[model samples]
Target: MKNVYITRIAKFLPNEPVENEEMEEKLGIINGKASKARRIILRNNQIKTRYYALDKEGNVTHNNAQLVAKAVEGLCDDTFNKSEIELLSCGTSSPDQILPSHAAMVHGFLKSGNLEVNSPSGACCAGMNALKYGYMAVKSDQVKNAVCTGSERTSSWMKSDIFEDEVAHLEAVEQQPILAFNKEFLRWMLSDGAGAVLLESEPNGKTPLKIEWMEGYSYAFELETCMYAGGEKLEDGNLKPWSEYPADVWGKMSLFAMKQDVKLLSENILKKGVASMKLAMEKHNITEDDIEYYLPHISSYYFKENLYKEIENQGLHMPWEKWFLNLQKVGNVGAGSIYLMLEELINSGKLKKGDRIFLQVPESARFAYSYAYLTVV
Candidate 1:
């Protein structure tokens, strides 16, 4: 079997780190029940500081294209030729536009003409999917070099009024939709970051992580309605696209109209995550003991203990102490998370040459999961 190696990794986080207190103030979650609810969400998530693509006044400072391009450039050797990159795979929860594709936009920023590009935008699993594509492209000998990027500008969507309007028009405050209730919850939970990795068919003296195997799974698309944007299934069983809403909900809401069932998500994500891990281990012909480092792209610290418990309940156990988490520092950055985690571990200089890394990536919107086994070389 041919091999693909991750030869380089880079990350771009814009602006200063924003703490929970500052985010709460910006979102006006001060005083009353809103304040209490904000505290619970922040404390439970354990996210202390996260970056945003914001200017000094807290406005969006960069778009998805700029963020991804900067990250990819960071991975480049100063003397490297840009044209050697045969493929560009990009993934993100939010994109600059729907037509040109995120990958195309990145190519434009790099001023590289006609290099192949793919935008595998599968919500949160998107970044992993993008990496998987680049890995296979090199493993199959189709590309000598490929760039895989994942970026999220969630702050752009954080200020939407759709959810607030839902609260304002509620027949009773208690009857407000989950979207309304959890709107500000995610606002404080999400931030901005971009991560990229350079995949090469052969390692050229650079430290590389040899890719052993990768697997992905998506269970029951019907569950997609559990978390989504641009549409909603009301309590009365009617499907309402953003267009069905009032005029104010038409433009920005169409781009960032998000709704989620927190209860259903929490219940299913753990089960699906463990199942995916089992499948990955089986395919890679490994056991929990084979793994030296456990890296999971989880959404929050609230789910950390639950994930471990589920892993044990599945009749398998991993070295929990080997697990690494950056959510407290960067928040849930969607697709950019896994690469950022890997980057941190690599830079920490802790792993031995032959160490095995178990990577778990779970996406909430589609209830999807991806796992990869990598070996340090």
Candidate 2:
């Protein structure tokens, strides 16, 4: 197989930074009442600022496809155009539309002409999933290069207007006065942004990062869905998809609202991933001493210490100095996270040739994880 290296990386964060204090002002209060869960969630998330594609009045400035197109457009200078792109792969937990697929929409926005395109779907690990597609495409000699992106325009769904119906539905059904914690929790957690990378058989910059290996595991059989959207978890722990329900209740129940089984997440998230991380490292002969940087796509600071301790117990001890995170600044961009972190690290000017960078991406959608190793070369 041919080797693949990330050639160019770029990111598009929509609009201006919305500070923590300004969140309610921008996202708006649901049912004309302040969220009781907002402060507690934000306190644990520790997200100082996050980007949103909506204005104070809830007007959209950019859609998910537009966010991706902007980032891809930044991949090359003015001379480069989308028509030359060999393959386009996009991943997102939140696609603007369900039918056309995210890549097709992005291709339309780019007017990129005919080319291979792929759209991978999931939550946080979706970005890494897209990157792996590009890496394999170039490594297998199927494409000279591939453009891959991971993005989210979650602000479109997080707006208070989207939940107003559900709020009223709760009152009619269960006498619940407001949106449930499961439904409203994400409104304060998610942000909007997109990140893209160019992958080629050869390295571009003098210090390009080489994709040494990629690994992924799924535990859907061993675990129920920990996070989900477009459906509700039944008493049997199975999902009753939105299609199965009557259309009227869709908006009323907020069936499409993204949520997690907090109990499942708190229990298995750190445990399951570290076991696989240890085995993968052992199989690859990677050791604690060899890793110089660790980039984990954590949705909140709540997991920082727990992740470190778990990995440490498994013998991969990366000190705080070795950890590189932007969650505090970027909030949780879901699938856009790893790409954004890689972009920031590569631009930080601290990397040197031969440095080993470890990436850990955990997806709570169904207890999945994707890990990759990169060498600065």
Candidate 3:
């Protein structure tokens, strides 16, 4: 089997950092109720806050594609020139416009010199999907080097009207805005950032991280249960969250979405991947004990808890403290989470040559991707 290796990885966040307390204050939640509620949620998730890009005026910035291109340029630098790159894939949720594709803009900015480019817009797994595609292209010898980038600028999507109304709702009840915050209705944890990774075909006479194999499985549930972009109309004239009228009045959509994806992964991806890994380990006369690092997608604090439990149930021992705790600082960068974590590990000297690493990705779109790599040995 041919080997595809990661040559470089880099991540960039805006200079401004926002804490939960500051957000509450900005939202006019003066009472202690909001602060208390935020405390409870933060305590449970071990995330105090997240970062976002801000303009010179100290307002949340709204340039998603531009920042992403800048980050990719920084990663490419002297190591790999634009002409050397055969493919450029960008994974992002926040696009300036729906037309022409964000990838086109990024490609133009990088001056990729006619390199093939693809821009994918999945909810949170966009980054991982981009990486997976790049791996396939290189493994198939369609490209010698590929660049995958994950970038998000949620501030662009911020609905100031909705925010004001939500805050008003809390004020009416004499409670803090945090007290009125609902996980299902409001997404307070998401922030803004961009990350990039460079992948190159292994060079002769030089050892590189071996990409053993990868598999992806997706299952779609009813549209009413988990609407990605559109939904039914609501009684009021105002459009639903994403410009569509709201339907499914019960608001159990997110719950159903989570259940469907979890079920699909548990049945189709995890069971088979775990079994295959076991078989491959035995075929190579290796054991779980031989693995040194594990990287899994970090979506939420609750997600990490459930994932860790599953890992334990599978009898896999991991260095949770070193390998899994980085999410606190970065939050979730969508598909770039695992790759960013790997970069951190390598830079910190925790990931060494010959170490075995497993990467598991669970996307919000009811898809799961798994990949295994053995450090250059």
lDDT for every model? 0.79, 0.89, 0.59
Cα RMSD of all models vs. native, in order, equals 3.0, 1.2, 6.2
- Give lDDT tens digits, candidate 1, residues 1-377: 46899988999998888887777444332212345556778888898998878765556689888999999888767656676688999999888876789999889999865689999986778999999999999998888888998889877677544345554445245563333544456776777899999988676534689988889998855564566666766786345776667776454233255556687788899998898788878876799778899999988899999989999999889767879888898888988999899999988988778998988988877688988889988
lDDT of 2 by residue, 313-353 (tens): 87667789989999988889999999999999999999988
Please report the candidate that would top TM-score against the real structure: 2
In Å, residue 65's CA in model 1 sits off its true spot by 1.4
Which tens-of-lDDT digit does each residue in 86-148 have in candidate 3? 898888766667788988988876676888988877756677678878888888888887888
Q: For model 2, what is the error of residue 38's alpha carbon versus the real structure, in angstroms, after optimal superposition?
A: 0.3
Give the TM-score of each candidate.
0.90, 0.97, 0.74
Weakest lDDT window of 10 consecutive positions for candidate 3: 252-261
Q: Quote the lDDT for 225 in model 2.
A: 87
- lDDT score, candidate 3: 0.59
Q: Candidate 3, residue 100: CA error in Å?
A: 2.4
Please report the TM-score between candidate 1 and the true structure: 0.90
